[model samples]
Target: MYSICRRIIFLETVAGVPGMVAAMTRHLHSLRRMRRDYGWIHTLLEEAENERMHLLTALHLKRPGPFFRACVILGQGIFVNFFILSYLISPRFCHRFVGYLEEEAVITYTKCLNQIDRGYLPMWAKMDAPDIARTYWQLKPDAKMRDVILAIRADEAHHRLVNHTLASINPEQKNPYKPGE
Candidate 1:
């Protein structure tokens, strides 16, 4: 009976160590990668470090009863799954709006480019047009929308550059800048 109790104790202690070590190693590796990848973003790095510290503190707390521990683990699993689901759902909605904004930008920029090419106005005159380029920096989105909008804005800027170059080449041409004209 004593031998059986000893074996059970040993197995219980030994079993958790490997799992804890594996989890700690994985978490540390992820933190290191995040730091490396986002070195320029100090705020993000700081937040990640803070979260890591919190997780470590939680891990080192005194052990709970078996039922309580099981409940805690189950709760964590549900929370994590819900968090991931919400994260995914939020981006889907954000991207849909971003697509709308991008499409609007393309149309507005195209119209401005068309007007400039047709000699209806000079390049400087159209600079303040209400296209993506003019208003992109003014708009703010939830975190997910910001990146998507910025990318779309960049593309619009590139298109503007190309169209401006084409327009400059033949200032006297009559509507030579029309799309596929």
Candidate 2:
């Protein structure tokens, strides 16, 4: 169970780092094409990508020991929760060019959230099996990691709500280019 969680965390960290970089790159490209003055937004996007890359590298270097695995899971939970909150509280922070590229930005955000919901979270839940949960409970009695894990789960659920809302608002639209289409 620990090894499974570690592998999932590693994959998720790697996948997420590149995904964030790509999203930021696309957003910047769109902004540049629009001749927008988005210096601050660009800086923020770069910072986000850098942070994700740093975390990914850290996870990559660390062996799948109990402590390292726990930290990776806890950190991922925090990161995902932070991302969801940031999006909900200020979507413009990430989607500043949405006015000029509404369809593309929305499609990208929806696809990203779908990946988290349909892929990452399910894998996370499965990795967190009974024995793993027991080990986690016994090893980390302070419950900080568990709390963060639950919060991440809730954040993922909230993402689903957001996705459903967006889909309802734009029912006719289709993301035909999405993977596994």
Instruction: Point to the candidate with the largest lDDT.
Output: 2
TM-score (all chains, Cα) for each model: 0.24, 0.32
Per-residue lDDT over 1-181 for candidate 1, one digit per residue giving the tens place of the 0 to 100 score: 2232232223223222222332343345447666331121232232233223322322322244687556656655664455344424452332233334334545644554454466654432323322332333343333222232243345544333333433244322332323311
* lDDT (Cα, 0-100) at 66 in candidate 2: 78
CA lDDT scores, all candidates in order? 0.36, 0.41
Candidate 2 residues lying further than 4 Å off, grouped into runs, are 35-62, 65-142, 158-181
Q: Deviation in angstroms for 129 in model 2?
A: 18
> What lDDT is obtained when candidate 2 is compared to the true structure?
0.41
Q: Candidate 1, which ten residues in sequence have the lowest lDDT sum?
A: 37-46
Query: What are the candidates' C-alpha RMSDs?
Result: 25.3, 14.3
Residue 81, model 2: lDDT of 65
For candidate 2, list the clashing residue pairs, or say none: none
In candidate 1, which residue ranges exceed 4 Å CA deviation? 1-89, 123-154, 157-181
Give candidate 2's error at residue 144 in angstroms. Answer: 3.6
